[model samples]
Target: MDMASVQLLPDDVLADILRRLGPHDLAVSRCVCKPWCAVIDARRMLPADAHLLPLSLAGFFTVSWTESLTAYFSRPCASIVVGKLDYLDTDDARSLSVADQCNGLVLLHRPTLWPDDQRVLNPVTRQWAKLPPYPHLVSPCMKQDSYQREDMYLVFDPSVSPHYEVFLFHSVPYNCYEVDVVDEDAFDPAVKKMEWPPSSYTLRVYSSKTRQWETKPFIREGEAAGTIGDMESALSPGHCHAAYWQRALYVHQHDFVIRMTLSNEKYKVIKLPLGLDVRTDDEPEHYLGKSEKGVYCALLYGNNRLGVRIWFLDEICGKMDWLLKRDINLGNLLANYPWKHGDRSWTTQYVNDEIGRSMTPAGAKFESDYSTNDNVIVPEYTVSLLGFHPYREIIFFRTSFGRAMAYQFNSSEIVDTGYLQGKGPHDCVGGSFAYTPCRMGKLSNNM
Candidate 1:
């Protein structure tokens, strides 16, 4: 009996199978042939149900280095190591950590005692290109040896275009900007915080196709930080998050949502939904997250309940209507987490309690109420919202000791993800973020 060759299958049938495959499988499928690769690239589409699809999360990363013994200034030593999640397999022994992840390419920023070099790496293809330092680091106007990270975003879609663009939002500062700096307070009349906009943000885009970084016209969507314009009833700026929705970018500023229409290249600032908590007088515990419906606001904790409100964008420009999604009381929810509830020490204690003593079936049950910390061993601990799973209705949280956990909205159950990497004197320095991997070699050269 002869086996069927996938090569002999019609292109349509091939695409049907590839479409249903997860990202990991699709990446491996590229090696079949050039034709098969092209077909996968052109037919890339997100699954209808986000929770149903397999997530390509790569795990969070951070720069690891030693403190130098310089008399005047404390700097990091030369040997740089990137501390990734214990779950990931980033064996690259070269850099400090990844700076950003575009569609499929990761900008791995390697900092020496200084940020000596940066590079764009295709983890999927094992291809890397050394990137030049950002202009602020090398420009004459800026002081030497003092580099700060500028907010950056990668604009690319491997399925649509081979060319990728990197956007760097920065404010190049001189060593002493006191005399030349355009300080925020300089704006008179104190524009209402709600009316305040973000205009001071400048940008530079590096195009892979052009192989050069060029200044681009960046359009700020909201009022440049509120001017002293006389409006007595205006609100002040509050805490917000930058979110992408409906092919647009929205940022929570003060008490308003700043909208940027990518298609029309326009900006519009709108007030946030009433009753949704915004940081005005106190630190806000809510986060503005993107969802299929539109922009959604998830209040970390309010009235002792987890609340979710999703916005419905109106056809009339920047207008939006927010509707209440659901409220879940998370009290004692962690009490039923699926995974084992204790640390190494707790496990030892449980074993001793069971075997050392006359262990009965009822006495053998392991105690779940316990906490791990640097100082005290408390029986109970606190938990706060960190963020959401990219696609699912899973709520991610961090305990007092930095242990990450997830609670499924649909399942009404909790699971312990893992404890974060925390060690040394400054154990809290090392943290993690969610990463979504990109598929390399998926685009045609048509770009």
Candidate 2:
């Protein structure tokens, strides 16, 4: 067959060949000719995970506001800064919190006393747009004697749809009344009793397509979600992450994981590991995450921050069963390991040279500068579980000392996997998230 005939291969046949290549190589194949480019764009137009087979972990970048560094780990063990967000290009007390990540887009807002500053950012292309906060009525200004609840989430998957959305699960309190009213009009003023159940949730959703804020009574009426925290606590950033997996918003609690469907606005509860008791005050922190393995809960145990017990969920005959995956020993890893702090700066000029987009990580340099935090080498250390390596079973987390590390479940190895905060004392709220890069054009299409 002539070269023209080969280039004119059927769409499916050509796609099959392209699928075998890595995302980077597959992207380059598009430059071969107009036919190949058409085939590539056609594939992206559809919203399927299969279409993204090449993007396994192609564009993973780290945004560390504490250090004002936005980078990605170059293979062996080091971080390379592609570029920093202008909004976060300062070293002030701007409380930037990563609310959620999906399809390479992240929802960032000030997790401070005022959370009104919100934006959806595409770190790869350095493109972002402002976002409107939830309606005022749903979150009243003045305090009242009633129950309140609020949950936030960022919903986006570039391949499936260009539309990006943010959900504000909020509810205001109302006066609770009892049947034992005096003369069927009022109850005793001296003794008062509030309602037993919590208040209903009002969902406020913002869509990039319409650029509008819309509110609706939660579809599951009468179902009350408990208050996450109080006002003062809310002002301080908390790790109340709402993970988007399998097109559902998943939130973890002590007893169950709430799987709220995005399509029909319905919710279902998936119980946690049987007989698992988790508390914040004096107990291990419980965090939920999704991976190729499945939905799993990481129970951080040991008063000395010694171990993390991971449990992956399994289903047997429609019954949810929990199976322990691995119990990672931090003490073993940190017992006598040498800790080094190195400068996390690298070449990013070539990053945008090709496509004018993010760069492929050439890995980071871990040259010992002896400038790392001494606290990170302390005997006792705590950690906050982040997400995972896009394609591997490795888990990512930040130590109390502000260094991010990864635990390879299958390999039984540990390595410095990320950078979001360095010495000083961001402590832990510097905020870190794992994401794969999607094109910036997707956002513009939605607009």
lDDT of 1 by residue, 1-447 (tens): 011576677877866776677654565554466666555555554352122112334333322223210000000221112222222223433333554544346554543424545556554444556555656533222334434224455454443455566665432221221233323232233222333233533456677776778765546654553432322223322112455544566655444565656566566666666453533333225556544344566554443233333334453554455665655555445544443434321110110111222111121122222424332334354444544555556656555443555666667666655443222212232212233445443222221
| Model 2, residue 388: C-alpha shift (Å) | 2.2
Stretches of candidate 2 off by over 4 Å are: 1-54, 57-81, 87-96, 137-149, 171-200, 218-237, 253-256, 271-281, 315-320, 338-378, 418-426, 444-447
Clashes of each: 11, 3
lDDT leader: 2
Q: Against the correct fold, how does model 1 do in TM-score?
A: 0.56
lDDT tens digits, residue span 5-104, model 2: 8667887786676567654455556546666655665675343323342234432334444433334433322221334344443333234445666666
For all candidates in order, the CA lDDT equals: 0.43, 0.52
Superposition error at 332 for model 1 (Å): 4.0
Worst 10 residues of 1 by lDDT: 67-76
Give the least accurate 10-residue stretch of model 2, judged by summed lDDT: 345-354
lDDT of 1 at 103: 39
